[model samples]
Target: MKFERSEENIGNRVFKGALFVAGGRFVLRLFSLVNLVVLGRLLAPEDYGVASLAIVVIGFMQVLSDMRVNSALIAMREIDERHIDTGFTINMLRGLLIAALLFIFAGPIADYMNEPKLEDVLRVISVVLIFDGARNPAFTMYQRNIDFSKEFRRRVAATILGSIAAIVFAVLTKSYWAIVAGTLFGRFTEAAFSYWKIPYKPRISFREWKVFVSFGGWLTLSGILSYFTQTIPQLLIGKYLGASPLGYFTIGRDVAQVATRELTGPLVVAITPGLSAIAHNTQRLRTAYRKAQAVILGIAMPIGVGTALMAKELIAVLVGAKWLPATDVIVWLGPTLAFTMIASATDGLAMAKMATRAMFNRALFVAVVSTPVFGLAIWQGDMITVVYALVFRMFLQTAVNMYFAKTLIGDSFFSPFTSSWRSLIAAAAMAAIVSAVPASFTPSDPEYVVLLEMMPRVLLGAAVYVLAHFVLWRLAGRPDGFETKMLEVSGIALGKLRRFRRTAN
Candidate 1:
């Protein structure tokens, strides 16, 4: 991982890689909004709840199969074709097994949930696991090479196609089947695009089987535990409270998750490869880890807080008033997801260091601690209680994981807080100003008119948040931060674009 003087521009490449990923996510969010808003209007909450439950089942199987082979591949100092072939062979086998399991057990799972319709949904969606398994494993090369532009294009196309499929299916059937169609189409596109985009072909080999398993075994365990921790609540809620309530819970969680999960997605994509590239240098690794957390929180914290404050208007405008029961769920989940993002981001640094044992232990602790909390929430049979349980679990998990990450990076526990406190303070100030505004935009008549009323409040809140954050950021003497780095990256990107245009001319 040592860089020669000629290769000292790694930092620049890292920034450029981040720009592509962030830009892709920016566009993908627009596609997701279209998917969510249109589908929300077309399908009932019960439809969404059923589809979501089915997805959770499929998702768990996929996670169980993910032995973290790709992550291991990226972390390695060098990986030959043998390693790649082994990873691919293992993946294909796992995919087939998971798909078969889904197909075979779909009926039993449906019976357990007491939703007979879910069996069909599970069988239909099981094909995605095969597509996922068959996808080219070479896409990690784009990440390892610090080139995300190609990855961005691949994702954007898939999202656009998937959103189109979802809308069309929703219009045609108006059943939960529409969501399943979109999910399947998206996975199939991603799997097909991988081989087309990369020069890799499927080949069966196990020459490096032990190498892959040794590195990925803990990752596989950790993935399974993490998925179960996150999804068990959805399962319990669907069983105990029924589909419509789970639908409301799911939608609310989705809206709140955008602030944390969606925003953090690209950051993780960029940073994991970047951090892996420099893992040999302890000092550099420490600095990168600290700065990354700061950047994520600086952007994510404000959005979470602001979204929490404006959940009512957001739900009314985006999701329609019939879904208003999810408002409280959104408020709590907004901050809950914020903490989860922080925890997940720190874990990425550990992954770069190959600290899977530590990572697994943390995941194990959270799973052990949170299972009862989720059970209690289900027992209470209230969506708000479920959200509160999640918030509490995330808060505890963040602290424990940060402690483990701190040990690896040799950084003090306070480093993240030092880098991130300004953003929190700024968000608080912005929230105060936005909250003081009159609550005059709530519509009393038709639900569709609520969208018109929500526009002004949303615009006002966004305007105030931006102005307040920037003013305070500057007044604090403008430390080296996400804003400064983003401007530098944008300048580099613009210069490159201009050069390309010149060459074209």
Candidate 2:
């Protein structure tokens, strides 16, 4: 009974966390979808492409400036006011430096890309980095404390405001600069609102600088390498393929990331701090890791496979015909995205063990392997080749991360894999069946009509996948009593929802 209760608790935590994340992701993605639709109509491809280059540069620098300190802070078992103050100070200083650098280099960068307008755009976006850097480290504390309700409210407000600003500006100016302006406004608004919502205030004292550096330094290294690994492809594409092709690539990557972000990312954010709380207990850690893996894979694998199969219709319907090129890109990158979801689930173990160096090493290896492959692909002048290189790198990165996570958690490599393989296989089979369905069901009506026609097939695929997944799981020795585990997860989610309601009241 004790064992059962413990298992039940794990199920509950995962379920509730997943629900919170799923809900937050849905709202955020919905806002983004609306923003994209409006902006896509208003702005030109070249406009988006030019901004994409600056954003890639800014994103890379921003990761270095922030250094994932928020995550490191949340992962720590004992944190104090001084730690928060010192972390904020460090973050602000880093942000200031990076912003200044970008401002200074904006001219040269614009010149290199043969786009003079980007200089001002880059300068304007630097302000956003500074504001984001100035955010109170107490926000991390909120997450550490598992107070996502507050976080969720702040995020939704910021997103809504930002989306409105972007759409308004894009419609008014019909230029690329409006997108940059909108982003800056939204970010600064979020920083200010987040500070207002959270209780912690910032002090410029470096009193806990030593401790912050000791932990955050490793995180900073890992973040820098990870940022480079993800962004280098874009940078290379912009440089070689120029803005047009880079624009298309950026649009495709953004669509894929947005779709997966709401689905896979929120779970990581919600689970990591909780996982840190129980990190010292190997059994608890194993349970958390396994359950998180199962849930993420169960959702992500099917979505990814289905997205790959339905990329054309989905992109056409959602983003319009102008985005047709993104469909092929999404298809090629889908496998990597699926595997990446599983790899992210193990991050809690790494943080709990203070294995920052190991994480950094893995990220460095991926960056090194991928940089040359990306370069080669760019040199070869083919988008498909670039996509294949990305998939290969993702596989390599996932394999490496899994080895380290398994070593840390004292679980076999096959443990998490076996737990979800049945569902994955079923999802794949279901995807094939759904993909074979004809598009003739749609009459020669409006575009929205065609989208409506595709919905049934998508829903049918999902239903079949879920049914087949359950059947396969049961046949595979009913690992963890699949139905019981789901019930446990649902119960926990419900309890959390109740607690949140009570707290709200």
Tens-digit lDDT track for model 1 on 127-151?
9999988877777777777788888
TM-score of each: 0.93, 0.92
Q: Write the per-residue lDDT of candidate 2 for residues 273-316, one digit (tens) a residue.
A: 67777777899788778777777777677777777777766666
Candidate with the greatest lDDT versus the true structure = 1
Candidate 1 local lDDT, residue 330 = 83
TM-score result, candidate 1? 0.93
Clashing pairs in 1: none
lDDT of each: 0.80, 0.75
Model 1, which residues run further than 4 Å from truth?
A: 1-7, 444-477, 487-505
